[model samples]
Target: MKPVNIGFNNMVMDERIVAIINPDSAPSRRLREEAKLENRLIDATLGKKTKTLIITDSNHVIMSAINPETISLRIGKGE
Candidate 1:
Protein backbone atom coordinates (compact mmCIF):
# COMPACT_ATOMS: atom_id res chain seq x y z
CA MET A 1 0.00 0.00 0.00
CA LYS A 2 1.17 3.49 -0.82
CA PRO A 3 1.78 5.70 2.22
CA VAL A 4 1.09 9.40 2.37
CA ASN A 5 2.77 11.64 4.89
CA ILE A 6 0.34 13.62 7.04
CA GLY A 7 3.06 15.53 8.88
CA PHE A 8 4.96 15.13 12.18
CA ASN A 9 6.52 11.98 10.79
CA ASN A 10 3.10 10.40 10.39
CA MET A 11 2.12 8.37 7.36
CA VAL A 12 -1.11 6.64 6.43
CA MET A 13 -1.90 4.02 3.81
CA ASP A 14 -3.13 5.98 0.84
CA GLU A 15 -5.40 3.28 -0.48
CA ARG A 16 -7.02 2.76 2.90
CA ILE A 17 -8.05 6.40 3.12
CA VAL A 18 -11.73 6.90 2.39
CA ALA A 19 -11.99 10.66 2.81
CA ILE A 20 -10.01 13.76 3.71
CA ILE A 21 -12.10 16.32 5.56
CA ASN A 22 -11.66 19.68 7.24
CA PRO A 23 -11.82 19.22 10.99
CA ASP A 24 -13.68 22.47 11.63
CA SER A 25 -16.95 21.20 10.21
CA ALA A 26 -19.78 20.21 12.56
CA PRO A 27 -20.16 16.83 10.85
CA SER A 28 -16.45 16.18 11.08
CA ARG A 29 -16.50 17.07 14.78
CA ARG A 30 -19.35 14.63 15.32
CA LEU A 31 -17.44 11.96 13.43
CA ARG A 32 -14.40 12.50 15.60
CA GLU A 33 -16.50 12.19 18.75
CA GLU A 34 -18.07 9.00 17.47
CA ALA A 35 -14.70 7.60 16.50
CA LYS A 36 -13.36 8.41 19.94
CA LEU A 37 -16.30 6.65 21.57
CA GLU A 38 -15.63 3.58 19.42
CA ASN A 39 -11.90 3.69 20.16
CA ARG A 40 -11.08 3.91 16.47
CA LEU A 41 -9.53 7.36 16.60
CA ILE A 42 -5.83 7.84 15.93
CA ASP A 43 -4.29 11.12 16.99
CA ALA A 44 -1.49 11.74 14.51
CA THR A 45 -1.45 15.45 15.15
CA LEU A 46 1.30 15.00 17.74
CA GLY A 47 -0.26 17.75 19.90
CA LYS A 48 -0.43 20.18 16.99
CA LYS A 49 -3.66 21.81 15.85
CA THR A 50 -5.79 19.39 13.86
CA LYS A 51 -6.34 20.59 10.31
CA THR A 52 -7.64 17.47 8.67
CA LEU A 53 -9.67 14.38 9.45
CA ILE A 54 -8.72 11.28 7.49
CA ILE A 55 -11.31 8.51 7.39
CA THR A 56 -10.00 5.06 6.58
CA ASP A 57 -11.71 2.09 5.03
CA SER A 58 -11.52 0.19 8.32
CA ASN A 59 -13.61 2.79 10.12
CA HIS A 60 -10.58 4.43 11.68
CA VAL A 61 -10.37 8.19 12.06
CA ILE A 62 -6.99 9.92 11.97
CA MET A 63 -6.30 13.45 13.09
CA SER A 64 -3.49 15.26 11.28
CA ALA A 65 -1.92 18.68 11.51
CA ILE A 66 -1.45 18.81 7.75
CA ASN A 67 -4.04 20.29 5.44
CA PRO A 68 -6.38 18.05 3.49
CA GLU A 69 -5.41 19.58 0.15
CA THR A 70 -1.75 18.85 0.72
CA ILE A 71 -2.53 15.30 1.76
CA SER A 72 -4.69 14.91 -1.32
CA LEU A 73 -1.86 16.10 -3.53
CA ARG A 74 0.49 13.63 -1.92
CA ILE A 75 -1.94 10.83 -2.64
CA GLY A 76 -2.27 11.97 -6.23
CA LYS A 77 1.50 12.04 -6.62
CA GLY A 78 1.69 8.53 -5.14
CA GLU A 79 3.84 9.81 -2.33
Candidate 2:
Protein backbone atom coordinates (compact mmCIF):
# COMPACT_ATOMS: atom_id res chain seq x y z
CA MET A 1 0.00 0.00 0.00
CA LYS A 2 1.24 3.44 -0.80
CA PRO A 3 1.64 5.81 2.11
CA VAL A 4 -0.34 9.00 2.42
CA ASN A 5 -0.81 12.03 4.65
CA ILE A 6 -4.41 12.82 5.50
CA GLY A 7 -5.42 15.88 7.46
CA PHE A 8 -7.86 16.31 10.36
CA ASN A 9 -10.46 18.02 8.20
CA ASN A 10 -10.79 14.95 6.05
CA MET A 11 -11.67 12.82 9.05
CA VAL A 12 -14.05 15.44 10.36
CA MET A 13 -15.62 15.54 6.95
CA ASP A 14 -16.28 11.83 7.04
CA GLU A 15 -17.69 11.88 10.58
CA ARG A 16 -20.66 13.76 9.14
CA ILE A 17 -21.13 10.82 6.76
CA VAL A 18 -22.67 7.41 7.16
CA ALA A 19 -22.52 4.58 4.62
CA ILE A 20 -24.94 1.85 5.50
CA ILE A 21 -27.99 0.96 3.44
CA ASN A 22 -30.78 -1.36 4.49
CA PRO A 23 -33.19 -1.36 1.58
CA ASP A 24 -36.00 -1.37 4.07
CA SER A 25 -35.22 1.88 5.79
CA ALA A 26 -37.85 4.56 5.34
CA PRO A 27 -35.81 7.49 4.26
CA SER A 28 -36.86 10.21 1.90
CA ARG A 29 -35.64 9.92 -1.68
CA ARG A 30 -33.16 12.68 -1.03
CA LEU A 31 -31.76 11.05 2.14
CA ARG A 32 -31.46 7.75 0.35
CA GLU A 33 -29.60 9.48 -2.46
CA GLU A 34 -27.34 11.14 0.05
CA ALA A 35 -26.56 7.79 1.66
CA LYS A 36 -25.69 6.39 -1.73
CA LEU A 37 -23.32 9.29 -2.26
CA GLU A 38 -21.65 8.70 1.10
CA ASN A 39 -21.36 5.00 0.32
CA ARG A 40 -19.49 5.81 -2.86
CA LEU A 41 -17.08 8.04 -1.01
CA ILE A 42 -16.47 5.32 1.57
CA ASP A 43 -15.52 2.87 -1.12
CA ALA A 44 -13.25 5.35 -2.77
CA THR A 45 -11.60 6.80 0.31
CA LEU A 46 -12.08 4.60 3.38
CA GLY A 47 -8.60 3.43 4.37
CA LYS A 48 -6.18 5.93 2.99
CA LYS A 49 -2.82 6.58 4.67
CA THR A 50 -2.89 5.94 8.41
CA LYS A 51 -6.47 7.13 8.34
CA THR A 52 -9.09 4.87 9.84
CA LEU A 53 -12.88 5.20 9.89
CA ILE A 54 -14.99 4.38 12.91
CA ILE A 55 -18.72 3.75 12.44
CA THR A 56 -21.14 2.91 15.21
CA ASP A 57 -24.77 1.89 15.28
CA SER A 58 -27.25 0.84 17.93
CA ASN A 59 -25.89 -2.71 17.97
CA HIS A 60 -22.49 -2.64 16.42
CA VAL A 61 -19.23 -0.86 15.85
CA ILE A 62 -17.22 -0.98 12.64
CA MET A 63 -13.65 0.16 12.28
CA SER A 64 -12.10 0.61 8.86
CA ALA A 65 -8.59 1.47 7.81
CA ILE A 66 -6.73 1.42 4.49
CA ASN A 67 -3.57 1.62 2.52
CA PRO A 68 -3.07 2.08 -1.21
CA GLU A 69 -3.71 -1.56 -1.89
CA THR A 70 -5.51 -2.86 1.16
CA ILE A 71 -8.71 -2.06 3.01
CA SER A 72 -9.63 -3.70 6.32
CA LEU A 73 -12.49 -3.66 8.78
CA ARG A 74 -12.94 -4.71 12.38
CA ILE A 75 -16.35 -5.25 13.95
CA GLY A 76 -17.45 -5.69 17.55
CA LYS A 77 -20.47 -5.24 19.72
CA GLY A 78 -19.82 -2.63 22.39
CA GLU A 79 -17.18 -5.01 23.72
Q: What tens-digit string does per-residue lDDT give for candidate 1 at 1-79?
A: 9989999788998989999999998999999999999999999988999999999999999999998999999999998
Could you tell me the lDDT of residue 76 within candidate 2?
16
TM-score against native, each model: 0.96, 0.19
lDDT of 1 at 30: 98
Candidate number with greatest TM-score: 1
lDDT, candidate 2, 1-79, per-residue tens: 2222223223222233234332233453344355456653232344443233323332122223333122222111110
For each candidate, how many residue pairs have backbone atoms clashing (under 3 Å)?
Answer: 0, 1
Q: Please list the residue runs of candidate 1 whose C-alpha ends up more than 4 Å from where it truly belongs after superposition.
A: none
| Model 2 quality (TM-score) | 0.19
Candidate models: Cα lDDT each: 0.94, 0.31
Global CA lDDT computed for model 1: 0.94
Model 1: per-residue Cα lDDT at residue 21: 95
